[model samples]
Every structure is written in structure tokens, then in C-alpha cells.
Target chain A: MTQPTLGVWDVAAVSALLLINGALSVWLSLGIARQLLVAALRMVAQLAAVGALLTVLFGAASPIWTLAMASAMVLFAGYEVTARQTRRLAGGWGPGLGTATMALAAATVTLVALVGPLRPDPWHEARVAIPLFGMILGNAMTGVGLGLDTLTTAVVRDRAALDARIALGAPRFEALRPVIREAMRRGLIPVINAMAACGVVFLPGMMTGQILAGAPPGDAVLYQVLIMILIAGATGLGLLGAIVGGAWRLTDHRHRLRLDRLAPARPAS
Target chain B: MTNAEILTLRGLTSTALKDCNLTVAPGEIVVVQGPSGSGKSLLLRAIADLDPHQGAAWLGPLDRARMSGPAWRRMVRYVAAEPAWWADRVGDHMRHPKRAAELAVSLGLAADCLDWPVTRLSTGEKQRLGLARALEDHPPVLLLDEPTAALDDAATRAVEALLKRRRDDGVAMVLVTHSDAQAARLANRRLMIRDGCLRDAVS
Candidate 1:
């Protein structure tokens, strides 16, 4: 039950649907016509680039190439994490630590899934490894970034409260216990929400893509469930790493809240 | 204890305070008067090891650098002007509710105010509770920054009495205040800070 392939005219015909949307935007004075066109163009270009790369990758199916692509994906995701942070650690620590933790989490979970359950041919096949690694890295990066950003912001905003606790004889960890918990929760919320809303509220992208590619509905559901669980696990690990590492880097042995280590918050765009 | 330890700040400099040298004797009160932004608060923060500064500070023979920041802070507690409360219930912060009760009674807080939510506390209440919370740690040296600034005359007198009692109990105190009358009433020696330098105020 394979899906039919789209020819060039079919793509042009499908793209015409976007014209209707653009026309409606123009008619409504939404001022989003340019944005819609630009976004559509970007999507087409990005997908084409990705399609070309994937075709080469699938043909090669070499472990080294798969690992290299995975590494590149993790690196890009890590950069996105650091760039998204409102209040970040100064210097290389923010991005360096973030990337390190996200990679650790994504790699660990992906390996477990590959070896344990979804053992594809050659185990590290590009088709299985790249997409799995991509999903884990992308999700874990967001989680860790949220954790670090929230922790820093909370520390800065509640510094007086933290100092008061320290003054009252709280140890460093004890003083920061609440902030750390809040940060971890913030990091986990996205994954949790996705899990909660899966199947009932929305069909996840991976499941839809799998079904569109003519995979069995039951198989797609099973894979989606496994991926969601793996994402949650990766997110948890990455977030914990970021918060603990961030907390350690932000303070010294003397238990002083060395907020000086944090780069100043950037103004909202 | 140990001949009433002395707190000495020698050539301490921060962005706010210049090479300031001063000594505070245990059981003695040194009132610091200064214009706003004159670094009175910064002086206390530096001595408490809360901020980076040049030079040295010592409690008797123990150098500030020799001990951890927490250790130094535990010995020399700084009560900021606007204290912070993180806990929902006021009693959650009190290590010694019995002592707090006694202090609260003296400070005019209701008997059960400890059980009240911190969000319900007024600024004056928070200020008084901040003092009580600091005292719970029983720091040997006290760096008070305008502790009574938010209080009324009667409340101010009550705080003065409480602080004077602590002074008599052999606690070294550096009182940062703007009130000349408070200096006259409580200080054995009064110092004025202007342009980050400390000078002895004429009695």
C-alpha cells in the first residue's frame, strides 16, 4: 500500500493552494502576505536541500557518515539552545556546557534505543540513526536551554531571597533548591505537553510522516510512542545536566551566588 | 567569648568605598552616617564578603579570606534595607521560633504572626522579620543597613533597645543609618562617609 509519488506538475498544483492563502491574506489586509510567501519559499528550499542530503545519506548508509551527520545536527541544535537563552552564562560556558550536555543525553538515549529495541540493519544505519539522533538532539537542546535560561533568570530575580536563605544558614544547594526544581519543571513541560496531547489532541509529526509514507497505522503508533518516551528521557537527562552544571558554574566553593558569571540578559526582540 | 572579638577593615576598597580603614569592637556600636549612594551598604556587603573588594578584613585573628563566604557571612550578618522572603509561611524561615516569638513580642508583631503567610506581611513587618531572621543565626558581628528606617518612632525605639541589648551581650555592630539622633543614642563612636572615604563625625 505505497503512496503515489508527486510529479513536477503535481508540486506546482499543490503549491497553488498557498496562492489561495496568500490571496486571502491580501484581501483581509493581514499584512502577512510577504511573510507567508517568504515562509513558503524557505520551506521549499529547506526541504529540497534536506531531500538531496537524505538521498545521498541513504545511498551511502555508512556508519561514519551517519555519525558525522548526527554530530552536525547536535551541534546546530546546541547553538540554537544557547542562542535562545535570555540570561546565559558568560563566555564559552553557556554554549559549551549546553552542547556537551545535550549531546550526552541524545547520544545515550539514541544508543539505548538502537541496541535494545529498534535495531535497524547494521544498527547504526543512516536512515534509523540520523532521524533518531536528530529528534533526540533537537528536543534535548530545547529542554536544556530552557532549564539554563530559567535557572539564571530565577537566580537573578530572586537573589535577595537566595541571600536571605544563605544568611539564615542554608547551604548552597539548599538555598537554590526551589529554583532548580522550577527550572527542571520548566525544561520538562514541553515534552510532557507533547506526550499528553499525543493521539487524542494531535497526531504527532513523526507518526503522520510514517503513515504518509504508507507504514502500517499500528507500527506508526508504536514508533511514535517509543520516540515520545525516548524524547522525555533525553529531555530529563539534558535538563538535569544543564541545571546542575549551570548551578555549579554559577557559584564557587565559598557558596557565594556569583551572578557575575552570568551574561546580562539581552533585550527582547 | 574569646575577649569580645574585634572586626577590623584595613584599606578596603570597592567601587563604592575607597581604601576605608575602620575597627569595630565587640560590645561596641559604630554608627555610620552617609548620604544616599555613599557606600554605607557597600561597606557592610564587603565586610560580609558578599562583594569583591581590595584589602583585608578580620574578625579577631581570622581573616575574611581565610574562611568561606558562608562562614564569614554567618559571623557577620548583613540585613539589607528591603529584606527578602522566599517561603510562603513566615514560620518556615525561623530557625528558632521561641526566640522569634520573644523578638516578635518586643518588635510588636502579633503572637501568631509567625504562622502568617509572608505575602501578607507589610514592609515594616518584613523589615522587622528580617531582623529577627538574621538574629536567629546569632551572628557575632551585625551589619545593619537602616534596620529601623521603615519603622515608626515607637517601633524605632523598640529596635534601638533590642540592638542595644545585643551590643551589651558582646556583639560587634556596624550600624549604617542616616539619623543623627540614632547615632547619638546608640553609637559609642560615629563615622560619616562622604565620597567613599570614612571620617569621624564630631560629637
Candidate 2:
């Protein structure tokens, strides 16, 4: 009982639903009709492009190609992390730190999962490795971005408090512990919520997709659990790396609160 | 390098402030008077090792270069004009609540003020508490930036009196202020800073 494959008209049927949204927007003078149209178009185009690329990647099934795809994803994720920040570190550290930490966390977790549990016939098999890497990278990216954003924003807002603590003889790490704890909590909250709400509040996207693809429910559940556990590990490690790196970048060996190292915040859009 | 000089700065230079050299003997208050944005705060921040600056500062015989920033700051504390409170209650911000409470009482703060939420503190009250917070550990050297800028006359007198008491206890201080009367009353030696330059004021 395999799920019917989606065709162009089947996709168009779904796409047509947007016309109703567009019509309502026009009727209400919401001014978002064009935006909605453009967003829908972009989503369709982007997803199609990714689907095509993944097909080609799977056919090739080469380790180098798989690595290249994963690296590209990691790079884009790093850029997204930086773009999400309101007040980023000065001197290109925003992206540099994010990319480095995300790559490290995602790559480490993905490699461990592949080698340890999944154990694909070829451990670096593109079909298995690329998707797994993408899922972990996506979740880890969000965590790292949130952690970095929280840390930088809090540090800027609480500069005086940090300075006072440092002046009061607190070490840099000791002074930043509270802020870092907040960052870690914020970074992990989404994943934690997903874990709590999985299967009950709503089936997670991966499990839903697997079920639709006709995988056995028990197998899908086990796989989803494994992926989620791996994601949590990756997110935790990535957030910790990004936050600690941010804290280190914000201060110096002399323990001065280097608020100057942070660029002046851009006005909220 | 005088043994009597508890706090000594030799050629301290920051981005805004240049080539500042001064010394404060134990039990002395060196009042720095300058117009706003004269880099007075920069000078104190540099001495506290809170900002990057070129110079050597010594706490008595100990060169600041040898000690970590926190270690140096422990002995030579910098109290900002508007000190920051990180916690909800004033007591949470103080390392030694009992000592801070004792100091707060002397500074005209209510005995129970430490238990009050930080939001309830007026500007003058925060200033006094900032002083009390800094004094809790009995740092040998204090770099005070406009410590009484927010106080009323009576409150100002109380803070000044407390500062004088700290000085009498051999706590050397470099105090930044705009008040000449306060300077005259408190400073054993007065200096003036203008456009990031420091020199002896012609009294």
C-alpha cells in the first residue's frame, strides 16, 4: 500500500489553494497578495530544485558529492544563523563562529549516527548520509543561531552588569554563566518541545513522511526516535559551542567585557 | 614606585585619554575635575583594567601586569556613576549583604533597603548602594566615577562623609567629579582633566 506519488497536477491542486488566500488578501486590501504569490512561487521552485538535486545526488552516490552537498547545506545554515542575529559580533565573527560550530556539531553527530547505529552498507552512502546530515544540520542550525542571538543580545543589554561583575573580581566564564545558561535553555527549548509533543500533540514531519511512504509504523517510530535523539545531541553540542565561542569572543584574556567587539545593533525590521 | 603610594599610574593612555600619569598615596583622595566628556571616566576605567590602555598601574608593590584582570580589580575596584544591578533585590547584587547593609545604613539608606526590589531604588539611592556595594570587600584602591552625581545635598554630604571615612581607613581613591566644593573638601591633591589631558589644577 505505497502512497501515490505526487504529480504536477496534484501539486497544482495544492497550489490552487493559494488563489483563495490571494483573493481574500485582495478583498481585504491586505496588500500581501503579491507577497503571498511570490512566497508560494519561491517555495515551489526551491523545493523542486532541491528534489532534482537530491535525485542526481542519489544516482551519483559518491562520497565526495555527498560531502559537497552537506558542506553547502552547512554553509547556508551558517549564513542563515548570522542573518537572524540583530546585533552580531564585529569583524565577521558572527558567521565565522556560527559556521564553525554548526559544521562541527552536525558533522560529528551525523558521522556518529551513520557509523554507530544506521550502519548503511556504505557508511558514506549519499542516499542515507545526505538526508540524515540535512536533518541534523537543520535542527542544529536553529539551535546554534538562537543560542548565538540570545547570547549576543543579552551581553549587549547587560554590559554594565557584566562589567560590574568583572570589576567585582568575577572570572569571565563565571560572570557569563547566567547569560550562557539562558542561551542554552532557549536553544534547546524547541527540540525539547518537539520531543514532548511528538506522537501525541502531532506526529513529527519525518515520522509522518515515513508513514506516508509506507514504512512500517514501528520502524518509522524507531527511526524517528533515533533521529530526534541525534538532533537533540547535535543541537546541545552546537549551542554550547556557539555560546562559549561567543562568550570568549565578547571578552578577552584580560577579562574586560569587550562590548566594543559587538557591532552596533541594526534597527529591528 | 614610592612605598607610600598605594595606587600609581604611569603613562596610562586610552583611545580617548592620553598619557595620564598619577599617584594616590594611601589615605589620600585625588579629585579629578573636568567638563563632561573630558575622558575622566576613561582614565578611571583604564586604571581599573576595565578598558584597553597603554600604561602600567601598581597597587602598592604589585604591578597590575603580573596579576589577572579580576585579581587586580579585586584590590582596585571601579565604581561607575550609575552602577548596574543584575538581580531583583539589592542584597542579591552584594557579595557581603551584612557588610553592605552596614555601609548602606551609614550612607543614609534604610536598614531594610537591601531587601527591597531594585526597581524601588531612586537614582540617589542606587548611587549610595553602588558605593556600598563597592565598599563591601574593602578594596584598598577605589576608582570612583562621579559617585555623587545623582544625590541631593544631604545625601551628597553623607556619601562624601563615607568616602572620607574610607580614605581615613587608608583606602586610596581617584575620584571624578564636577563639584569644586566637593573636590576641595575631599581631595588631598586636586587635578584637572581637559580634552583627555590631565594636569595639576591651579588652585
> Compared with the true structure, what per-residue lDDT tens digits does model 2 show for residues B1-203?
11234788999888788799998889999999898999999998999999888999887789999999999998888999999988999999988999999999998889999999999999999999999999898998889999999999999999999888888888899999988989989999999999889999998
Regions more than 4 Å wrong, model 1: A1-24, B1-4
Which candidate number would show the highest TM-score if scored against the true structure? 2
How far out, in Å, is residue B68 in model 1?
2.4
Cα distance off (Å), candidate 1, residue B101: 2.5
What tens-digit string does per-residue lDDT give for candidate 1 at A1-269? 55977687889888888899999999999989999999999998988997899899999988888888888887788789888888889999978989999899899999999999999878988888888988888889878988888899999999999877776556688889999999999999999999999999999999999888889999999999999999999999988988999988877776767899998899632
Shift in Å, residue A113, candidate 1: 2.2
RMSD of 2: 2.0
Q: How accurate locally is residue A193 in candidate 2, as Cα lDDT from 0 to 100?
A: 95
TM-score of each predicted structure versus truth: 0.92, 0.97
lDDT of 2 by residue, A1-269 (tens): 65868778887888778999999999999999999999998998989999999999999988999989998998889889888988899887968998898889999999999999999979998889988999999999989888888999999888888888998889999998889998999999999998999999999899989888889899999999999999999999989999999999899999988888998798533
